[model samples]
Target chain A: MRTAFYISDGTALTSEAFGHAMLSLFPMKFKHRTLPFIDSAEKATRCCQQINAAASEDGEKPLIFHTFVNTEIKHIINQSQGISYDFLDHYVEPMEAELGIKAQPKTNRTHGIHQDYNFRIDAVNYTLDNDDGVSTKEYGQADIILIGASRTGKTPTCLYLALQYGIKAANYPITEDDLDNLQLSYDLKMHRHKLFGLTIDVERLQSIRQERRANSRYASLEQCQLEINQIEHLFRQEAIPFLNSTHASVEELAAKIMDEAKLERHRY
Target chain B: MRTAFYISDGTALTSEAFGHAMLSLFPMKFKHRTLPFIDSAEKATRCCQQINAAASEDGEKPLIFHTFVNTEIKHIINQSQGISYDFLDHYVEPMEAELGIKAQPKTNRTHGIHQDYNFRIDAVNYTLDNDDGVSTKEYGQADIILIGASRTGKTPTCLYLALQYGIKAANYPITEDDLDNLQLSYDLKMHRHKLFGLTIDVERLQSIRQERRANSRYASLEQCQLEINQIEHLFRQEAIPFLNSTHASVEELAAKIMDEAKLERHRY
Candidate 1:
């Protein structure tokens, strides 16, 4: 049988998706297999050796799709004589060429120049910095603070903004205690001008919460309704620009925040 | 103030990611905003109107990055006066033309003859009845199944697959119960062949779990090691091919499965 091996250095998810997508598009068919290696260069080399041995024993030239960033694995594969393999570098190289930007497809950037600002901003927001029992002036450092009940897509939106836009986004949950108080976090209130609120339909929030907590009190529809209404009222009374996350995706919500905050989308 | 609107039918997360990625490569900065609307014709029209108003008020022809798909929005925008916009259709059309594909960039499939047999095989695999109950025989019906422990990137991988691929993949946790029981769920066993497992290093899983539930039994080093060892033994014993989810993206994970399972990847 004609064989195609999908070798992965990190995870093989993208490779598998692309392989399936490509197989669907192409008219040809081949026996397919995947080998996902962890952060080990040695394991990747061993896997390559296994593939080469299998191909040689079968006396068939196997088509290999190797996806990895480890130079050791690459060197081993390049030296292998038994199997005919193609690297995914061919498919990804063009996108960079066309886009006129050099993004390392395999190396995920945690922080650097040309990284998504939205991701960085969110990363900065979630980190805690406290002094004694009281909060410090950390709130003033936030570019924007998102307040909403759990399951309102606050965290994801904050992350997307910080990771993709390089905007420093912070988010706080409107816990039952916060709802009862009908006020922003004490620390957040100090920087209330930068605070934004996210409110979603109780029914929607309930459904989302249910996915995580099943039958917990936090996932209860009644509790969701009570909290959403109180949060909305508090946001309006306090004049925090609020958004309904009922039907919006994280991308949509972040977009709404950028619009309302009049913030420039910092790309690089 | 030059305004740029990134409008999309997708969840705002993707819109913002694409917008930010694109803008990162651009040379100049503009007043950026994202406006997300549900699949309402009126909302789309109103968004177009808002773009026009914003552009006119700013006295600069705003570069409206329209990520939406409704033809009516395009029709309305084309009919409107004094605004410039870049539709995804036009943006990818030249590229499509260069690629010699008569199909549009957005349209996924062509109407005509049967294409790849491998995709047809995947279609059949989902339909085949299995004697084992573990087989989500409807595994084909899964948007995505994430098989991992408490913190082996299962949830994020699942969310990414669902959000990015729009695949209806379902995820099942491989708990101690499943392992002690010596088999996956009846439905999963029946669809065992369709099941794609995600494996990660014990240390990595522990660290991630610790972030969510610190100092707990589930997050403990010894507990994590045992669970990982047990789960890995089960995967190996069952002969279920798996991937390590460490440092791999959801895109890569889902792609790997699609490739391994030989499923069709639909265009967004």
Candidate 2:
């Protein structure tokens, strides 16, 4: 059994995300350890020792995935016996050459909270307050209004967009009544330019609803099918771009919506 | 004016996050462009041309921040006139030398959604269902229960932890009755081990509350101060680990809670 380490100068999310993605491609049985906020040289030395110890015990060099901007700390970890894949060192030089500019390397900056932190916080607040069509008081302030049948991955996607990109996203649930009427709500029509729709596979929708209310009409496959069909039809008729959320994760959904809507992420 | 580009073989979040962080440190005006999912040699060639054109127009080399796993793509982009900072080329060789293994170069693996995507979605569902002490049906299933006064950043943090880390977090608001009585709810007491408290500065809390209901008794500064004091006292008496969310962003708050509680993020 081999060991894999994800180390970073900040929250280590990038390293962990990259490592998991890469490991998924290879048929390897490995134990993974994540070490974040290794911002100092001393911490880097200790990390190297840990990696070396793991390598010795396993009798196989461990794979280390790292994203560190600090050169001194990266150098110290490079001396470790484990095979390291440093994210910054590998791509910075070529990018510098391509751009005709020197790269600026800094530790713990990638995930640090900057001046726009408040903007992200406000976005989160706006998302929560406007969730599930709870209150339309803030609709005028929303950057995007997500409309979907209940449990089509609207709330999670809205929160993800808000938290990650500081995008003011508000989600409105498309109820059975609205689907029967086959019309967009007056409020949605007014803000139609900001409206994005989400739909899901019938089976997935039924299963998701089943988890909330089992063996009921709401959770029945037939009901899910009817709702999905109407919602897709409404989307096509209204010319509002919609995505099938059954196969897409929230991140993919958010990215797709942002790209399609030409919505700029308010990150600083 | 200068052009700054974030280029990547995958989602480009790492390159964008790093570039933004580094640029924040320097007082320079730059127009930023992010190009994600540039996974092929053809895409790389097009990106280089865009960078070159921008450089020629601006009469200054544009800054390119890139994370590419493909060596050929990286080499092609490096030949461009713009200043290129390639994340992979600088560190992969040293790491390979140290670990005696060749780096597996692949694109778009870092942020790929896999089987764990369902787990994250389930977590988000759980969090939203249990938010703001609305339902105790899933309190028994919560990995962590965040308790705080209103407008103290409980809901957003719970959502962030769930969406970003796949942690099933639930939040319960400390209402006026609970504060006046200075006691935990029976449900919260039953699962005190999972209870985590959040407190904010009195003034901040007042302002946040004022935004929701301006000039009301509930939104008064005195009410916020009284509630905070009571909550802090209750936390100390009950030996509940709590953090001050007044100055911390949701990301920082989530990380601190996960670390303090030793809760493993269930992300795949």
Candidate 3:
């Protein structure tokens, strides 16, 4: 059995992301553990002892991924029995050399409260308030408006964009009424330049809707097929940019939408 | 003026995080650009040309942070007239050395649809359904239940935990009646082991509430003070672990809660 440890002085988000990426490359089962907020030398020392114990008990060296800003804490953890991969140590020097500037090793700055925190909070609120076309009176406030049939992965994508990038994303569900006429809503037409469409395969849409309401007309394959066809036709006729959500994850869809829309990510 | 470019073969989340961390160390205005899904050699070449042009126009080397899985694409982008910091290039070798395995250069694997994707979607659904103590019947399903007075930053923290870590989090608001009685709700008492409390300064709570309802008694300083005092006392009486949310960001609060509650982060 193998063990993987993610350690950091803050939330360990960076270490976790890098560790997961690297670990997924290998074909092995791993017992993942996370030790966050190891900001002090004492905490680091205790964490190292724990890691060493795990290594000895497992009869294999544990893989430790760390992003410690404090040199002292990082040094202590590095002396542990496990094979350590210090994320900051590996890349910060190269970045400094390339940019001709020294990076300030600030702990927790990646997710700390900065000038952009309020912007992120406001974006989340905006996305929640404007979700599912609940309120179109504030369409002008959105950076992008996602239009799609229900169960096309719109709400989660909007929430992801708003939370991750602080982008004010609002979503509107393209109902049967709208799809039948092949016309955009008056509010959506006013903001046509900001519209992005999402369409999914009939089978996937049927399956998703089935989970919500089993054996209903809304979850029927014929209904899903009809809606998808009409939506795609409307998109092509209106010259609106759209993507297929059947194969792409929410993160990919959000990133692609932001790129196609030329929306700037709000720095936080 | 400075330009910071974050490039990647897939979502570019890693590049964006590292670039933002490095840029925050410097106190200067920067025009940040994100270029994601550069999955081909042709796209890489075009991106390098853009970087070179930006460098020449700015009269200073632009900073390019990248995580290209394709070696050829990485080589092409590295040759651009800019300072390049490749996240994967710097760390992959050491990992290979430690693990005795070659890292697979897979694009879009970091945020792909894995087994954990459904877990995250379910967690988000769970959080939304159980938000603001609207439905406590399913407290058994929650990994952690956050309790606080109104405007104590519970909802956002719960959502962050759910979205980022795929943890099923539910939140309860401590109303004036509960505070006056200085007792936990009957439903919450049943799940005492899963309870985590949040407290905020009276002024901060008042300000947050004022934004929702201005000049009302509920948003007044006296009400905030009374509720905070009672809530803290209730928390102490019930032996519930809690944190002050007045100064901590949502990310920090979520991480700390997970740590203190010994809640495992559900990997996605």
Candidate 4:
């Protein structure tokens, strides 16, 4: 198999993003490697050797997706045997002309600390503190509160929202007791506008719960069906917006919620 | 302020990454907006109207960085009153020729559900369960274990590692009592090869602690200085690699640790 390298003078995150996006369009698999923080002439020389080694060992020119603030360093990598795709380089000049400003390339600018850094950390802490119906007192400060049947993927979705978009996401689990009444609590009712529901197929929920508590009544298909049935009914009756997470990744669920909730992301 | 839009038919994560990476080059602020999940011609028409409105509102052509798999939807967006930069357009043909294959574009392919999605969820659960020295019994399964003084940025980095790379990262916070002998515990010793350390500036550590407990002994600068001193000494004596998190963001820290440890990432 051919190899693909993502190299940069800083975090190499943008290079990885570019390469990954492009590679996803192809049907075949490649060996992926990332060489980040390559900030020196010596490191660039060593990187060239690695690229050449991969080329000879794989009997094909490796694909290199790289971003470098230093032209000399970039030139060194370009001299290697690999096929280099400087994706951003093709558009920077046109963008400069359109924006009427010269580009000031700098290392680490793409994924560095910014004024919004504190917001991300604070969001993470807030999400952790308010996870899994731990406390409803802080619901007033939440940007969006996710309520769903257990094992429908509330915790990971909340963490992704906080970590990626800096959204203050808190989640509450709808359990067996809540199933009897099938009503939103006063705390959730007070924040109804911020409520978002998640539901999963009964078999998916049963399998997930089975891994947690094997052979228990909670993991039984009957119980899973009953819980999902009531919770989804409650969502429809209360006019709460919701989605099925049976086939969605956490990224998809988080992005969909951010859009449907119309929440302004405290973007990085 | 000028307006810049990131639009896509799916989650728009790739569009956001591409736009943010490019925009970070210019030293100017622009009002940023993201329009995601615009998969229909009707939604595309609405998006164009919004783009035109932003153009009229800002008195300039709004800059659009978009990726659309649907040609009809792309055509609708192309009619908008904005300066469009179809970034990936220039490279696909050349890459296709190089790889001897046709480019197959699909919505949500860049950030969609994949076989490795389960690894990410499991890693997140593992990281949360093993957070802040909560349990060392699972250290054997960790790809990397981060050790540092409290409030030195262990939790957020671990979460990022798990979410981004699907690496099981567990963190342990070194407290004041552990500063006496400054020796690794038996559990940590068993997994010493997987250990990586983090340190921060005394001033920053004190301020972070101060927010959690103001005017407390643990938040004192002198005390923070002492703990950092002992921890740094311990890392050097034990030949453990460490980095200062005072100036690094979570992305930077996670990437650095992954590179230094040379752990294989379960790429998405």
Question: TM-score of each candidate?
Answer: 0.44, 0.86, 0.95, 0.99
Q: How far is candidate 3 from the true structure (C-alpha RMSD, Å)?
A: 1.9
Off by over 4 Å in 3: A97-101, B25-29
Ranking the candidates on lDDT from highest down gives 4, 3, 2, 1
lDDT of candidate 2 over A1-268, digit per residue (tens): 7789988866676677556655654544678877776878898999999899998999988888986667788799889998877544445455455545676655566566777787888998889889999887778999999998999999989998899889999999999878768999888999999999999999999998999899999999999998889999999999999999887778778877876788887775
The Cα local distance difference test for each model comes to: 0.57, 0.81, 0.85, 0.91
Residue-wise C-alpha lDDT for candidate 3, range B1-268, written one tens digit per residue: 6688999888888788777766766556677888899989999999999898888888888899887767899899999997887666667777777777887766778877777777877888888889898999999999999999988888888888887889999999999777767888799999999999999999988998899899999999999999999899999999999999987878889989988999887773
In CAPRI terms, model 1 is classed as incorrect
Relative to the unseen true structure, what is the C-alpha lDDT of residue A38 in candidate 1, on a scale of 0 to 100?
35
Q: Per-prediction RMSD in angstroms?
A: 12.9, 3.6, 1.9, 1.0
Best by lDDT: 4
Off by over 4 Å in 2: A17-27, A38-53, A66-85, A89-107, B8-10, B21-29, B37-53, B68-81, B91-107
lDDT string for model 2 (B3-120, tens) is 9898876667767755665564454568787777676899889998988999889998888877666778888888887777654445545645654566676556656677678888
Writing each residue's lDDT as its tens digit, candidate 3 over A77-189 gives 98999888766566666767766677776677777787887787788889988989999999999999999899888888888888788999999999988976789989999
Q: What DockQ do the predictions score, one after another? A: 0.07, 0.32, 0.62, 0.80
Select the stronger candidate by lDDT from 3 and 4: 4
